[model samples]
Target: MKTADIQPFFATLKAANPSPQTELEYTSVFELLAAVLLSAQATDVGVNKATRKLFPVANTPQAILALGLESLEGYIKTIGLFRSKAKHLMETCRILVERHDGQVPDTREALEALPGVGRKTANVVLNVAFGQPTMAVDTHIFRVSNRTGLAPGKNPLEVEKQLMRRVPGDYAVDSHHWLILLGRYVCQARKPRCWECLVSSYCDYSPKTPPPQGSLR
Candidate 1:
C-alpha cells in the first residue's frame, strides 16, 4: 500500500470504532497475561469463557500457583491444549512469584522469558497492558494485513515489523485490535465480506467479494 493510502486506511477503521479493544476479557494485568497465554490456537470467546470461571478463583499469579495444576486443568480443560496450557501457567506463575514478585512483566524480554509467553504474547501484553504501540500479528491479523496489502509479509514477525513501520502513529496503538476484528468478522478467511468492509476502497485485493446475490441486509 502507498504511504498516502495507509493513513486513510487506518483512519476508516478508527472511524468505525473509535475505541477498539481486545475481545479477550480481563480485569488485572495478570489476568490479561494469563488469558493471552491461553489464547493460542483458541478463540477469544473460548478463552473468555474459561477465564470467566478461572479468574474469580485465581486471578493472581500466586493464587493461580496455589490452585495447582489439576484444578487449573479442570477450569480450562474445555480449551484446546488445556493440559499444556495448564502446565505452562503453573510454571509461569512460579517464575512470576520467584522472579518478579508475582507481577506480570512490562518488558518484552522479561515477558517472553515466562514459560508460555512468546514474541506474540509479549507484544500483546506490552501493548494491551502497558499501552505500547506494538503489533502482535496472529492468524487473523496476518491474513488481513496480507489480503489488504497493508503490511504483507511471509511470517508474523515480518508482518509485525511492517505494521510497526507502515501504520500511522495515530492508529498504531489500536491497529491490532482493528485488524483482528476486521479479519475475524468482515475479511474472513473463507469468504471475505468486502461488500460491507469499510476500508475496501483502500484494500489492494482484486475481485472483492460482494454480498450474497439478490440479497440485502
Candidate 2:
C-alpha cells in the first residue's frame, strides 16, 4: 500500500468505531500491564475472564505484590505459562514499587526494564494506557502488514518500524488495534475471510477468497 492509501484505510476503521479500545478489560494502567503480560500465547477472552477476578482484589503494583505468586497462580492458572507469568508479575511489581513508586512507568525503556514487559508489551502500555501513537506488532498485525503490502518484513521489529514510518499520524494511535482485530477475525491464518473484509480492496493478497455462491449476510 502506498503512503497515500494508508490514511483512508484508517479513516474507515476509525469511522466504524471512533474510540476503539483494547479487548483486554482493565480499569487501571497496572491491571492493563499485568493482563497484557499474561496475554502472550493466550486469547483476549481468557485474559479478560481471569483479570475480571484478579483485578478486583489487586489493581495496583504494590497490591499485586502483596497477593504473592502462589495466590496469583491460582487466579491465572487457566492461562498458559501461569507459573512463569506469576513469577514475572510479582517481580515486575517489586520493580515498580522500588523503582517507579508502584506506578506503571510511561517510558518504553522503563516499562521494558520491568519483568515480563518487552517491546510489544511496552508499546501496548504506551498506546492503550497513555494514548500514545505507538504500534505493537503481534502475530495478527505481522500477518496483516505483510499480506496487505502495508509493511512487509521478516521480523516483528522490522515490520513495526515500517508501520511507524508508513502509517499516517491521524491513524497511528489506533492502528495497532485495528490491524490486530482485522487479522484475527478477517485475515485469518488458516482461511482468510477475504470475501467480507472491509479492506479487501486495498489488500494485496492474491486470489482473494470470494463469498460463497448465492450466499448473503
Candidate 3:
C-alpha cells in the first residue's frame, strides 16, 4: 500500500478503538504467559474458558508447578493438545521458578527459552505484558496484513518484519491488536465483511465480498 493510504488505514483503526487489548483474560504477567502458551492452536475464548478455572486455583508459576501434570491436564483437557500443553506449562513453570524468580521474563530471548514459548508467544508477552511495540503475527494478523496489502509477505516472520517497518510509530504499540481484531471479525478468511469495514477503501483485496443475501447494505 502507498504511504498515504497506510496512515489512514491505521487512523481508522485507532479512531474505532483508541485502546485495544488482547481478548485473553489474565490478571498478572504470569497468568498472561500461561494463557498465551495455552492459546496455541486454540481460540482465545477457549483459552479464556480454561484459564478462568485454572487461574483462581494457581495463577503463579510455582503454584501451577505444584498442580502436577495430571491435575493440570484435567483443567485444560477441553483444549486441543491439552496433554502436551500441560507438560510444556509444567516445564515452563519449573524454569521460571528456577531461573527468573517465577516472574515472566520481559526479554524475547528469555521468554522464548521456555518450552512452549516460541517467538510469537514471546512477542505477545513482550507487547501486552511489557508494553513493547512488537508485532506477533498470528493467523489473524497475517491474513489482514496480506489481504489489505498493509504488509504482505509469504510467512509470519516476513509479515512481522514488514509491519514493524511499515506501521506508523504512533500506531505501532496497538497495531497488533487492531489488525488481529480486523481479521477476526471483519476481513475474515472465508468471506471478508468489506461492506462495513472501516478501512475497506485502503484494502488491496479484489472483488470485496458483498453483504449476505437479504442483509441491508
Candidate 4:
C-alpha cells in the first residue's frame, strides 16, 4: 500500500481506539511475560482465564517459583502443551531471578534467551510492557498482510520486515494491536468480512468478500 493510503488506515484505527491495549490480562511485567508464554498456540481468552486464577496467587517470578512446577501445571493444564509450558515457565522463572534480578528483560536477545520465549512472544513483551515499537507477525497478521496487500510476505520474518518498512511512523507502535484485532475479528481466516471493514476502500485485495446475507445491520 502507498504511504498516502497508510495514513487513513491508522487514522481510523486510532480514532476508534485512542489507547488500545493487549487483550492478555496481567498486572506486572512478570505476569505479562508468563501470560504471553502460555499464549503460544492458544487464545488470549484461554490464557487470561488460566492466568486470572494463577496470577492472584503468584504474579511475580519469586512468587511463581514458590508455586512449584506441579502447582503451576494445575493452573494452566487446561491450555495446550501444559506440561511443556509448565516446565518452560518454571525454568524461565529461575532464569529471571538468577539473571535479570526477577524482572523481565527489555532487550530482544535477553528476553528470547528465556526458556520457551520465541521471537513473537519477545516482540509482544517488548512492545506492550516496555513500549518498544516492534510487530509480532502471527497467523492473523500474516494472512491480513497478504490478503490486503498491506505487507505481503512468504514468511513471518519477511512479513515483520515488510511491516517495519511499510507502516507509517505515527502508527508503528499501535499497528501491531490494530492489525491483530482487525484480522481476528474482521479479516477472519475462514471468511474475511471485507465489505464491512473500515479500511476496505483502501485495501488492494481481489475478489473481496461481500457482506453477509440477511444481516440486521
**TM-score, per-candidate, Cα-based:** 0.98, 0.96, 0.98, 0.97
lDDT of 3 by residue, 22-69 (tens): 999999999999999999999999999999999999899889988888
In candidate 2, position 63 carries an lDDT of: 85
**Residue 144 of model 1, lDDT score:** 95
lDDT of 2: 0.90
Q: For model 3, give the 10-residue run with minimal summed lDDT.
A: 61-70
Ranking according to lDDT, highest score first: 3, 1, 4, 2
Task: Give the per-residue lDDT of model 4 (tens digit) for 17-113.
Answer: 8888999998888889999999999999999999989999989889989999999999999999999999999999999999988988999999989
Provide the global lDDT of candidate 3 against the true structure: 0.93
> Could you tell me the TM-score of candidate 1?
0.98
Q: lDDT per prediction?
A: 0.93, 0.90, 0.93, 0.91
Q: Which run of 10 residues does model 4 get worst, by summed lDDT?
A: 208-217
Question: Each candidate: how many clashes?
Answer: 0, 0, 0, 0
